[model samples]
Target: MVALDVVHASNARLRELGPGLVALFVGGTSGIGEFTLKAFVKNTISPRVYLVGRNASAADRIIEECHGLNKDGKVEFIKADVSELAEVDRVCKEIQKKEKAVNLLVQTQGNANLRGRDESPEGLDRKFTLNYYSRTRFISNLLPLLRTASTSPPNFARSVTILSAGSERAINLDDIELKHTFNGMRCANHTTTMNSLMTAEFAVKEPSITFSHTFPSVVNTGVARELPWWARGALKVLTPFFKPFFVGADETGQRQLFHATSGMYPPLKPAAGSPVAAGIPLPTGTAIATGSDGKVGSGGYLVNWNGDITGKKLVIDYQAEGVSKTIWEHTQGIFERVEKINEARA
Candidate 1:
């Protein structure tokens, strides 16, 4: 586990990195995303942030809090239901209209649906769409902006998805959506595995942008709110008893900020000799992180909640089997089908 002191120390350097950082936080109204945004506002200097969520009231409150922390910070809330692929595309386009480049794209937009499989109007699983498809769509549409950021001032761009990472299991390619084999645990596992594989593919394809799929490890983010009433009640009762074992919001925020800014995960080619990019410093006692491809700093990282590389053999074995390419192709097919359906409806 990466020490908390180290995480704190590294995050402290955000302010010293200077201003003009642009970040987009999907699902920042509450939970881990909100906590991370607050930590970032407190530590950074004059950052321009765009908060995307469904709740305008919550966004208003968050924007107010961010402004209170850094008066110079610019925070705008774009209201949208991220579960829809079309809405995800619209939000990306909106961001594109105002900004030429984005330094950080952090996505934590998902819910734990314990009842059963729910399908959206797009004929895709709702939880799967929110957790996987929508997030991937955002990245695909914003690739231009991210690439622009990669070559611009900060000279690096990062995409972080908060989900299960260390525990990647074999995905049934025959049934990616788990049509026949549908359950809460299976859905979560498949989405997370897909996340890791797709992130690896992006890393290999872009090389300029750093992609990370991280497991936040039992964060009490109210992810269970979408679960059935009985399950929600169980969580409410169990949470108080299990609170000591869980990571706090503040620490998770700091660690997330560290993941975004620190040198542990750098671009594929680090400015010739330097291990990391300009303006970012490596944390003490933390060496260059090994990528999902098994090379040190190859750009894609599967990180654990404690800010360490997952270092799982499952990841290595899957990559060796060329699963990343399979995932990319499968994801592209989903996008095409979804777009066709949207066009038909239009």
Candidate 2:
């Protein structure tokens, strides 16, 4: 596990990297995303941040807080419900029009609804869409900008998705959407596995853009707000007992920032000049991380909460069985179907 002192020391170097770094945060209005956004604004020089979420009031307060921390930081809120693919596309278009490239893309948009399977208006499971499909859609739409950032002045581009990493369970290829088997635990495992596979595929396709699917461990993000009253009450009663195990929101943010900029997860081709150009020191202690392909620094990483690489045997076995490619094809098919439906409606 990487020490907190190491994470903080690395994050403090963001200011030295200079100004005009552009970052996009999905679900940044609260929880870990908000914490990371605050840390980024506090440490970076003249940072331009795009905060995307459905909460305007929260965005207002967050923007105010960010400005208070870094007077030169430019933070804009683009309101959208990320659970829908069409909405994700619209938000990406809006961002693309304003920025030439994006240096950092952090996605922590998901819910912990334990009541049961809830479907969205788009005919997809709400949690599944928010946790996997919508996040993938954002990455697909923003690839060009991320690619551009890799070669631009900042010269480094990375995407980090906060979700279950090391705890990935078996994925049923035939039941990709979990239509046949729909339980909360099963759904969580399927989405987490999909996140890891799809992220690995993306890293292979775009070696220049570092991709990481991280498990944030247990944090008091209040993600269980949609749970039933009984479950909520039980959680409330047990909060005092479980609180000690949860990581602090601010510390999680610092570790996340380290994952985004550190040399530990370097791009396929190390950019010209020292690793410091991208903001952190050269990777030390841990050997260069093994990518999804089992090679060192091939540009994809599965990280755990303590800032360590999570090389799960199941993930490796699935990739060997060609599950990653199959998952990618299945995801593309869903996106095509969604696009056709949207076009017909239009």
Candidate 3:
């Protein structure tokens, strides 16, 4: 696995990859997305950023902060509840109307620790809607704009999802919504699984877009604090061990920036002589490579916290049987249903 220091070196080489680019970040008002957005604006010059969030004040603060740091990049904030389909559609449509092309789309809106199953007014579970459905909906609606922003020949548009690495486990396809059984850990695992499935599906259908699902190592983001009091107490005890080895917020942001702009992860193959540095830390456990068609990466990458791309593991211990296909079909069905329901309401 590549070390963070090496990833920083590669990041230096990727300085201008994001300049003058149009990036849309959902969940950028707080947490990892916010941290990464800060890094991008500080690191890159003259970029236009679209920051989407649920809070107007937080968005405004982020924009002000970006402008204060780098007056060159233009920042726009769109207030939208990402869990809702209509809001996603509206915001995306508005963005498309304003910008001719969209260079990067980052999805980091879902929260794992939802206390209970809360269904949206549209008859979809609120957590699933935010974690999976809304993300795909935004991607589907923004494809035209994404295609417009495509860099020909070598550079492809980028799509990135911030998913926990825990997704590499067994998922019951029959109960994606987890109505029968519900808990924070289970929800978190499912979120990661959905992200992996959706990412693989996107990779297959859209070769022009680079798809990445980064499993960020533990960073002391207080995301655990957002959990139940007891869980937070438990995690607090573990923070000492986690922090030293954990990827810091800035590093996480930088790694994500690498994924969003460096064109490193997708097409599932690194070009010759590029010699990109690895991004994850050592002991980055083995990863199963997904092929260009979403099988597994032969030359495929298991992204580490440091940003290096490593070879796939000898044993893919996870149960991937039909998971990808099931996720694809289920996701598409959700989108179709959401669209029709939204249209009918309209």
Candidate 4:
């Protein structure tokens, strides 16, 4: 487990790099995204950050607090319903119009609900879209700029998407989307496994940029807001018993920021001569994390809540069967079909 002290120490060193970092947070309006983004602003020196979500009021409050934390940092919010692929494209276009490169792209967007199979207007499953499709859309749309950032030294190109990292189980390869056989549990497993597979693909395909899929264990966040009153009450009544395992909001921010900047998760091929220094220098006595490909220094990481990588073996056999190609092709088909449908409608 990466200690909280080490998380703080690495974050403290961020400002020393002096301000060329450009970060984009896809779900920064609230929840884990906001927490990590604020911690990032606290340590960064005048970073140009784009905050994407549908909440402008929340963005105002977050920006206000961010300015209070670091008055020089620029936090701009692009309001959009990210469940739609077209909206994801629009957000990416807006960011690309202004910035030449984006150093960090941290995605924590999701529809935390048990409503099951909520399909967006784009005809994709809403929960699946948020958890897997949209986040990948951000990474795909922004790859050019992210790759551009990686070409530079201290400014690293990293993408982090938060979902159930360790819960990757054997999914139905015939129906990767789970469109026909959808349930809450299946949705969770399918999306998490897809994230793992895609992370592996991106890591190999673009070894210069670092790719990580994380699972933030249990934090006291609005993830339960959509729960029914009875369920919410039950959780509240049982909160204290499980409180020991809960990571505090502050610590969540710190740990996530550590993931964002720490050198423990290095690229397959470092952008600069010194690969180990991709983000902050590696912490004392820690080796580079083992990637999802079952190899060290593979540039793709499936991280756990405690800021360590979880090389879950459930997907190993599928990996041997070359599942990454199917995943990438399926994902690309979704993106292409969605965009074409949107354009045709227009």
Candidate 5:
């Protein structure tokens, strides 16, 4: 496990690379996203960040706090319900219209709900869409900006989805959306599994860009607020039983910043002058992380909360099962169909 001190020191050195790093944080209104946003602001030099979520008041408050921390950096809040694919496209367009390059894209959207299959207007499950579809849509639509950032000669554009990376359970191949079978466990397992496979595919397709799918373990982010009162009571009563597993918000931000900017997880193709795609040069003795494909620097990584790669066995096994191909085709098909519909409507 990577130590906290190491993570902090690495994050502290982010500003050394210079300023004007453009970052977009989807679902940055609260929880892990907001924490990372604050950390990103404090560490970077005049970084331009786009904060996307439906919480305007919370976004305004977070933006205010970010400004206080780093007056030089700018945080623009785009209020939208990103669980919808169309909204994801709109947000990407807005960002693309303004920025030529996006150096960092961190997505910590999605709420794990026990509520039954809540479907969006687009006909995709809301939980699945937020955790997987919408996030990927952002990447696909914003590829031009990310590609522009990739050409920068170091640290090709990076996209990180902070979700369950280590947990890989088989998704129903027959029902990719869990339409026929939707349970809390299945929902959690399927979305994360899809994310893991999709990241590897994206890496292979866009070897110039770096992609990381990470599981943030357990965090103390007041998740009880969303649950029913009875569930909240149970959580409070049993807090001591699992409290030790929870990492505080401040430390989560530090580790997340490290994961997002660290050189250990580089793109498959190294840039000139910097062979490692050299993010913030790996802290002393910290080796480069292995990719999901079991190769060093294979462009895509499934990371743990502690700044390390998830086991390659699952990736290898899944690819052998042809799950990766299925996932890519399924996800891409949805994007294409959605684009066609949207264009026709326009």
Candidate 6:
């Protein structure tokens, strides 16, 4: 496990990146998202942030705290239940009209449970919609804004999604949605895997934007407490029983903030900076990548909370198993199926 200090120092270095930065954070209402927003708002000066939440009060409080921290920065509150496509679309349109560019998009929206299968009015499963598709929909709709917001030479806008990093082992490729059968662990695994696969697919299309699907390992932000009642009780009892315990909400948030601003992670980097070397070798046994676009790291990366790249071995294993291609196409099909069904009903 990487030290928290390393992550914080890297985040400190991101302050020099620039000004007029705008970040749109969905599900920033509580837990890690809320903590990350606070850390970011504190780090950047004169920043503009949009806190998207279904609860106006919570958003307003966050805005107040941000304003309190950085008087020069401005915070806008947007209310929407992200699981709903119509709401997600509306927010994107409103954002498009107002902002020419978007520097960061953080998606931490979704419920953590397997109580029952929940589907939105769009006929898409609510759990899948929030955890996976809503982020994709938001990204697709705001592509123009993201492109505009990125720095010239076109590589600045970054999207970070908070996912369970090491939960790949529980994935069920045959039933991605877990509709036929659902257990909490199994469902979380499926959602996390889908997020990883989908993030990889989107990275290919938007080479200019950097995307990271990070698993914040066992953050004790009471995030798991948001699970259904019985599950909450079980987690409360067993979480303390586990060794190498979870990090608290504040630390988890700081690590996430590090990911949000630092270009150290995959498919995204500063257009003119180099984090790796030409001829020098490193002990991590990490591979050096050269992109045709003059960008340092242009390939998609699966990252851990400590900010050091973990799960590459597992991701490669998944790719070798032929699960990667199938997963990507399945995700696209889900999006397409939803669109067709929505149109026919309309």
lDDT of each: 0.84, 0.86, 0.67, 0.86, 0.85, 0.70
Cα lDDT tens digits for candidate 2, 1-346: 8888878887888776679999999999999999999999999999999999988999999999999999999999999998889999999999999999998999999887775777766667888988899999999999999999887776778999998888888988789987777788888898999988877888888877889999888888876677888989999999999899999989988888888888788777756864553336654565567776677888888988887888578888899999988999999999998898888878
Candidate 3 local lDDT, 285-318, one digit each (tens):
4343344233554222335455544222211323
Taking every candidate in turn, the Cα RMSD to the unseen true structure, in Å, is: 1.7, 1.5, 4.9, 1.5, 1.7, 4.7
Per-residue CA lDDT of model 1 for 1-346, tens digit only, reads 8888988888777766569788999999989999989888888889999999988998999999898999999999999998889899889989999999998899999876765788887888888887899889989999999888887665768899988888788788788877777787878888888888877788888888889988887777867867889988888888889899899888889888788778888867544443335326876677888888788888888888887888468777888888777878888999999899989988
Q: Report the poorest 10 consecutive residues by lDDT, candidate 1.
A: 270-279
Q: How far in Å is the alpha carbon of 161 misplaced in model 5?
A: 0.3
Clashing pairs in 4: none
The stretch of ten residues in a row with the least summed lDDT in candidate 3 is: 274-283
Q: How close is candidate 3 to the true structure, as a TM-score?
A: 0.82
Instruction: Enumerate residue pairs that collide in model 5.
Output: none
lDDT of 6 by residue, 183-282 (tens): 6566676777766665665666776676777877776554575577888888778876773676777788788886665545545433444332111122
Positional deviation of residue 102's Cα in model 1 after best superposition, in angstroms: 0.2
TM per prediction: 0.95, 0.96, 0.82, 0.96, 0.95, 0.83
What lDDT score is found at residue 304 in candidate 5? 88
Off by over 4 Å in 3: 112-114, 151-154, 228-241, 268-302, 308-322
Candidate no. 6 TM-score: 0.83
Q: Which stretches of candidate 1 lie over 4 Å from their true place?
A: 271-279
